[model samples]
Target: MPYPIVAAVVATMVLLGIYLSTAAPDLTFWDATELMAAAHTMGIPHPPGTPLWVLVGKLASMLFSSAAPPRAITLLSVWSAALTGGAAAYMAARWLGARGAVVAAVSAGTMLTVWNNATETEVYALSLLVSVLLLVTGEFAGRPDTDDHERRRARALMAFVCGLAVPLHLTVLVALPAAVAFAWRGPRPVWREVVAWVALAALGLSAIAVLPLFSAQNPTLDSGNPESWRALVSVLRREQYAVAGLWPRQAPLWLQLGNVFQWSDWQVAYGLHPFPTAHPVRTALTVLWAWLAVLGLRRLWRHDPRVGRAMLLLVLSASLGVALWLNMRAGPTFGVGLLPKGTPHEARERDYFFVLAFWGWGLLAGAGLSAIASALGRRLPAPVAMLPLALVVVPLLANRAVADRSREPVASLPRTYARLLLDAVPRRGVLFAGGDNDSFPLWYLQQVEDYRPDVTVITVPLLGAQWYRERLAAQQLLEVAAVARWPGQGAVLRSLVIHAEGARRAVRVSTLLERSDRLQLDPGGGWALQGLVYAPDRQLGAGQTGLDLPALRRQRSMVPMGALAPLPPGADPAAQTAQELLQCTQVLGPADSLLVSGCGGV
Candidate 1:
């Protein structure tokens, strides 16, 4: 069999085997649930909306829609990861040789981050695949052996892929510098070809139109209302997350550099056994990958300066350049970034953004290994030299325990909580869930499993956006009176709660947001339920003032969060719940035992 075919097979087996073994059995936390719900409903997701992924996931769901929607989407990610691994392997073989291809396959197949994402519903795998294809096709276009007509076509196609990538994930743009370098190193460009490329890119980007179309369809699962051109621009531009895309004001330069360094180290050492950054073995392995990448670039330059220059630029551009840019780009990370006071910021993990950089390094690592094989040929027997190559599998062994997440019950914990909350409410009651974790599971249960069709699930934070408000109004979930006070995009969502109360609408609040000041979930003014509150005044209320701890405890579905397992040390549980709520409170959960005064009264 051909080496590329062999590489593909090897990569697929590794990726599929591990991913299947550890895939999420159902919905996951964060965007996983949202994505699954969106795809299942053929609707738009959070911006910049991942329309292409939604389409692909929708197709995947067709095969198992009756039995399991979560599995379908999770499997889609697994398949995408496998494809990415295959493509990575093929690229390595084409660039280096058979041995290098094996190296690349193992590296990508065993990557912890890649494996972690493979078993869930997420966009990274697809993003990785598209990015790798761009690299491969872009390189093929630059090759001297290619014909002129083919080269032009390849360039145009590459541009189209670039445009497609734009709507998928912003991180893919990190490859732009490398793409430019590849073109510069390849054949001279024609103005017509460049123009064609630009036009094709625009044509490809028309996928963004999927948002408005899907939004107009009135799907059971909808996020942003992109039907209007203005809304479309906001969704596509990710204006909702603009603060995150902008650079941080308070972070020091050195801390940002440190964050990048640690992030880079984690990427390289991801799946290595004993792979903690502080561990000596993991540190050495990270250093080895780094050194190999450096050596590989040198080898590439020696072999073909043009190709070498492109690959080098790609590595730097994708890795260091992206790392620097991401570190500089700040938002509430949940707690990943370090503060000047030596404290961690919000806890959201940001390592996923650097996968492309690690991808480039993976290619370079293969080249480096190939170069090593060449050098060892003079001193050692070929078979004996090849024996050392087998050591690359060590990281796979190391990462197995960490990456095996297939046994995790999809949305089991959250689903349990969701069912509890839903059951506690009367039929046709409205439920307000604050953050991704608190809300998306409810969406999945509704859109995928068809749970509680009569009940309404409103994502509170999303209510701030005018597009979202308009969407709610169009769906009859909201009336004109609900949003009359808010006239702008991304406005306060307090009126949503107030409107529901004024209309005598029965509502249930997520424990994560029950005590929020924004929506005024108090006990008075027709908001009589102690388990849930509706503050007509929207004033600062005292702790447990109107909270019904006994009623909350008596509910069969209300499980005490404190009774749950301990959170990781130094990890703030509040930050996770903080996504929707505007302020922290002494009472943390629906039940009294779950209360934490550590939040300090707001």
Candidate 2:
């Protein structure tokens, strides 16, 4: 079979698998829903904002008329990314040919960041697609044989696409250096052609201004308010740390440099610092693939300085952009708090320009592999020369094929939880859920039922105590006990509490069983109750579990029990909840052996 055909097949299968696995009723765990919600509403005022990409999602949702708007947007993104991958492969093949292109395409498809973003409603895929187009067109325009008309056309196209790209992601700025290099390389161009190219480039670059025009929900100057501006400035000032360290205070220059060289290695082998357990297998493969790509670029540099220079510029620009974006958005702080505390910020931050790094590196790797095989091609029989190449190709393709199948079920967890909560709680009742990785449950329920106006979904501090308190007062119920509440009318005293200190708090689960008699034991020996909590906890079962049903019913009809289970020592039952509430006169104090009334009614 032709190498192009094989590359197409591999790319298609990989994309299809990702789309199928991820397309569902809810959002991916990584706050994709928050972005989708903003996208659906065409609001750009939020952080990590992507005005152009959100518009694309909104348009697709309207066009398809699908009930699952986010899924539709995600599917569209996947398709676009797949096409981008194909275009990239074609370009690589055109530049390096056959074997090199196949390696590039396969490497891209297997890339953890690329595959992950393809299934999300983020701008990463769109940015990647536009970047690939820009690179390819720039390459074509720089060709020595290209005519004035063709070069002008390519320049205009590049400008228009770049213009469209800027609002989607600010990182598109990285392409400018590459563009300048390409424009300067070709034969002495006609002055008229140069003027046209410059004019088009300016026009394309202007599209970034439109970002502020999109609804106030976008991350532009209009929506962020004075504080947002302050945050942006704060982030900008820390640009050095953003690219180098976990935080400004603790960052060391040497360490940051080490991180850059060994980032792929560290991310894959040890994983990222906060989410150390994140996609280990993918991380490892990415590191290996990236290293190989660097090798390829080194070999190509000796022969094609232009290609080498272009690759180097693109990689450095994109890497710096991504690192800075991640730093600003994820935070100079280490661990999970690296990202902003809100869903909106998380959604936006997740679209860092790292995929560009992956692409540049992948191309370099393909070039490297091709150069190696070509060297052997001169001395050995054709089949013998191909043997080493085959070994590398088969494993990579297989890895991509396998990795494509490993996507997390974005829709399943939130949808299932929503169903369970909807069925478990009264139509008008408020549910207090502990920790949610993605904001999917809230968004999915809002889409299916108009209950968002009535239903309150809170995620501890990320949801903010003030907001949670306000919602609790309005709803007249506290669904989750993990949240801390100030003294208030609508607030009920919790009997049992669970809190996880540090980053684990994000994953901690808190449940409030309205009635103790309703509790049942599951086959796995985990307690089954009216409400289930999912929070981050160092010691799994150490938090306050058993609630006094009889006392709870007698004293407070709507009893709210919370557990603050920190890392090692755990929460002292007498100090955290029981005594704390007693001081507020909300608890039935000095009561021993409270009698159990029948589990009468919910």
Candidate 3:
């Protein structure tokens, strides 16, 4: 077999082994659950609708149907990551040779951000794959010795792939100009062929049409419901998330820029993080890694300047350009803007956005290490001289403690919460969920696993939308005007609970709303304890004040909660349950202690 093909296959197998060994056994929090459920049902996800991933994930889900629904869907990310490692290895091998391939593989494969993306159903893993492939393809297409016809074919292929990224995620736009320029090579542009390639690229972008196509069928979790031309345009343009043209800045520009380095410093020595625990060691390793990357990039410029220059542009576009574009709010600051008292923030860290940038830097570091090996050739044997490249594997080892999800307790929390809550809600009830974690898992369990299909889950955040309101009004048999009349989200929710009561159905709310000041759940005001969730019907209490230990135990037995048992007091909100339960809500037993600690805020 050809060397590049062999290199890709060998690297893919090795990395896939590591990735699968640590892959989440079930669906996870954030977008992973929603995307998995959407793929399984051929439904739509949030804005711009990620149709390409939906189609691809659908196939993976079917092929791996024997696994749990979330785990099956998560395989897509695992494969994308493995393929990414393969591409990185091949790219490094092109200039750094076999030893360079090892350095690049170790650096890219186990970088904390990249590994995190690999374990779940998320877009960035696949986005990183395509971006790396573009670098490889553009490098080949940029070769001066390549035949004209072949080069044009390669460039045309590059254009179509680039177009596919439109639906994948617009983040790829930063990598575009560099990739296109490199593919142009020495040939003077052929206008007619260029136009034809552009047309073909548009055709690839049309993959997004799956949003309207599948949406018209009205799947269970149609996020935007972009079935009509107008709605489709709105979804495609991302008007729902459009924040007045990416400015009026979400965070101070300096803090946002500072996050670029903040994210970078964590890549190689991520295990020593929550930093300051081993600050000196972390800083030294990070500096050494950066120094090697700069050296490698410099050597590449002196040797293969054409490709080297394009790569620097690609890395900058992927990292710094992305940081500016994202303009995210304060996310896990390392003393920079530590007190940005009143700024919007991301729900979670956004380091995954820079996977392409970090992965590219790893390849450069591999080349730089090879350059060092050459410099010491006279002093050391050829095989022995290259031993220093093995040191690059330090990142893979350092990050493993944090990045490995195989036995991580929090990784399985989403699945556990979804299953427990779904099983606990009374049949044909209305479950009002508070946030992404509180709501998405229910949707996945209902639509994909066919669990508690009769229950109506109303996500609180989406209630403000007219379409969402109308859908709820229709499903629950409420008057449209009455549904719209609610003065605020709190009012809208109270109405839903009352409506469920009138219709002889049970009412429940995720812990967020229950703990919130939004509703009147003061004992006499129609609310009862329902294990992990809260039932809003005073009737079920039967004079009870604490949890139903038996019910909680049954729910616990049904799902695998991983290693952690009974979250301790004052745990993070994502891991907490029943805020009011914290008022000395005494523990029942180890088995039912998910939130039984009765003194925390999840």
Cα displacement (Å) at residue 158, model 2: 3.1
Tell me which of candidates 2 and 3 scores higher on TM-score: 3
Q: Each candidate: what lDDT?
A: 0.64, 0.49, 0.72
Per-residue C-alpha lDDT of model 1 across residues 1-602, encoded as one tens digit per residue: 99877877787777677677777776567788889888888877788888988988888889666647677888888888888878777766766676677676667556556666677789988888787778777777777788888888888888898889766886666776676666554557879877998899998888887888898897866665778898788887778765454266335556555555665565444454332335566768878878877888888788767668877887677656765565543324322434444454634556677677666776677667777887887899998766656756655676665565543222254455555556656677767766777677777787777887767777777766666677667655566755545653223344455556666666666555534432354433222223322212223243333344445445523554432433232222332243112111223353434233322112
Candidate 1, run of 10 with poorest lDDT: 578-587
**Per-residue lDDT of 1-602 in model 2, one digit per residue for the tens?**
76655665565565566555643444554446556665565544234345567677778778766556656767766777787767766666655666667666655554545655676666777777787778878877776777877877877787677666555665565776776566545456678766876777677656444444553333311222213444344322433123434555233334333334433432222222223233556465556666677777787577566767887888887776545434432322223433335522222223234667766766676666677777788999877876655534433343333223223221243444344444433343334443433234464456434434343344433233333343443433344442344533222323112111121221212242223211211111222122232222223243323333343333343322321112111111212222222212122322322211211111
Candidate 3's C-alpha runs over 4 A off are 242-244, 274-278, 332-337, 340-342, 482-487, 520-529, 537-602
Q: Tell me the tens digit of each residue's lDDT in model 3 across 127-233.
A: 88887777777777887778888888878878888789888887666677668656756667679988978987998898988888898898877877788888788
- For model 2, state the Cα shift of residue 222 in Å: 13
RMSD per model, one decimal? 4.8, 11.9, 4.2
lDDT-based ranking, best first?
3, 1, 2
After superposing candidate 2 on the true structure, give the runs of residues whose Cα lies further than 4 Å from its correct spot.
Answer: 1-26, 39-45, 62-70, 187-250, 253-263, 266-291, 324-353, 391-411, 421-426, 429-440, 448-453, 458-530, 533-602
Worst 10 residues of 2 by lDDT: 563-572
Which candidate number has the best lDDT?
Answer: 3
